[model samples]
Target: MTTSLMHTSQQNQPLISWRWLSLALLVLCIIAFASASTSWLRISPDRQLQISQLQYFLNVGISYCSWLVIAVFANWMRLRIPLFSEKHPKWLLIHCSVAALISLLHILFDTFMLGLLFSFDFNFVSAFAKKVAFWLPVEMVAYLACVVSLSLLEQHKKNLKLPESEQSYTFEQGNQVRVVDRQDIEYIEAYDNYVFVHCANERLMLKQSLSSLAAKLPDEFCRVHRSYLVNLMAVECFESHSDGQAFSRLKSGKCVPVSRRRKMAVKSSLAALHTHIH
Candidate 1:
C-alpha cells in the first residue's frame, strides 16, 4: 500500500514548466528596472545628470539581460553543481568557464558604449576598469536572483509532472521483468514487508519480495543482507568491522549492512565470479 502511494507521488512530479517561469522572470525584470529608475530619478540634478542616469539604466538593463540569457543556457544544459554527483564535474566546469568568458566580453562592450556616450575616448585599460566598475554589484545581485528563481522554478515543475527525458517503467502487481542496465539501479532496500526497486535515473516503485528479486537479478548482483541485495557492478568499496560484520558501499555511497550468516559465502561467490570474469 505504501509502495503504491510512493509510486503515485513520483509519477505526478514534473521536471520544469517554462510558462510559469517566463511570467515570473518577466515580473522580476520589471521590478528591477522600476527600482533602478526610482533611485536614479531621486539622485539626478540637472539635464546632464538625467542623461547620465539614462546611460546607467540602459547599461544595467543590457548587462542584466545578457546574464539572463546565460542563465537560461546554463539551466537548459543542466550545469553540474560543486557537490552534485548526478552530473559530470568537467562538463559543468567547461560550461561555466565559457559563460564567464562571454560575460566578461559583454561587460567590455558595454563599458566601451558607456564611455562613448559620455564623450570619453575608449582606452583599453579604461574600458576594462569601467566594465569592472559597473558589472560587480549588478551582476552579483543578478546571479543571486537567477539562482533563487531557478531553484523555485525547478521545485514548481517537479510538483507538476516528470521530466521529458526520464522514461517511465511500469510493472503490474505480479509481472516479472529483467533489469538489464546496472546503472539504472540506485539501491534495493526492504520495504513494507516486501522488496522495493529503486533507480537513480527515475522514480519507480516495484512490489516484490527480496527472495523473488534475487532470482531475477543478474549474476552481478548478490544478496548481501537478508533485507538487502546489491549490484556488484555498482559497488564502490567495502568495509570490514570488528564484530565480523561488513558493509557493501555503492557508487551512490550508500552503505548497506551485510549479515554474518551470508558473509563467507558471499565473499567466496564474489571472488569466484571475479576470477571467472578475468
Candidate 2:
C-alpha cells in the first residue's frame, strides 16, 4: 500500500516540476518581448535617441532581470501570505501594501541599472516620482497578469488530478485491510489515534490520521475542521449558530462542525461546486 502511494506521488512529481518550468519560460518570453518592443520604440526617425540600441537592450535586460527576481520573491511571498484567503481578513490591504513595496523596489533597481549602463546621473526623488507616475500602472498590470496566469494553470492541473468515481481508499482495521470506494464515503472524523470512516450504513475504524487521509482524498473531500473531512457531495447544507459557529449538515443527517479557520475555504469550495453543478 505504501509502495503504491509512493508510486502515485512519484508520477505526480514530473507534472509539478513542469508547471514551474512553464511559468519560468513564460516570464522570460514576456520579458524578452517587452524589452525588444521598448528598444525598438526608442529608435525614432524624427527625434534623436539618446542611447544606442546595444545600450538600450542592456538597460532593458537589467530592468527585466530585476523584475524577474522580484517576481520570484513575490510568488514565494504569495504562497506564504496568500491573499484572499479566509485567514487573511485584511488581504486586500496587505496585497496593496506589498505591491507598493515591490513597485518601489522595481523602480529603484531599474534606475540604478539605467545609471550604470548609460553613465547617466539619477536624481533619486525625481526618478522615483517619474516612475510612480508613468511606470507603476504598467508594472502592476504585468505583475497581475503573470500571477493570474500561473494561478489559472495551477487550478487547471488540480482539476485534471480530480479523483474518478472508481478510485478506492485502502485502510487497515485490526489485523485485516479493507478497500472502500471513494464515492461510498460520507465523511471521515478523527478520534484519538483512529479515524472513523462513515459510509452509507456502515462505519469503519482505521488506524490513520485525518491529515494523512485528506492528502489521498479528492478535492470533493474538504477539511471542514481540524479533525473532520467531509465529502462535499454528502453535504446537504451548512447550519449557522448565533455564537458564530457553523456545522456542515450531511445528507445522512450527520452534522460535522466546521472550524472557524476553515469556514471560508469550505464555503468557497461549496459555492464552486454549486456553480459547477448548475
* TM-scores for all predictions: 0.37, 0.56
In angstroms, how far off is 151's CA in candidate 1?
A: 8.4
Best by the lDDT measure: 2
The models' CA-based lDDT, in order, is 0.58, 0.66
Instruction: Give the alpha carbon lDDT tens digit for every residue of 237-265 in model 1.
Output: 76789978798777877787889877754
Task: Report how far residue 227 has shifted in candidate 2, in Å.
Answer: 0.8
Cα lDDT tens digits, model 2, 1-278, are 21112111111232235357557756765776576567657756733253455446555665665567556655644544454556568855665566667777777776765565445555767766887887677666666555555556545645575444336666555565666776778898888877888898778876667777676666778889989999899999988788989999989898999998777677767765665566
Clashing pairs in 2: none
Q: What is the lDDT of candidate 1?
A: 0.58
RMSD of 2: 9.4
Q: What is the lDDT of candidate 2?
A: 0.66
TM-score of 1: 0.37
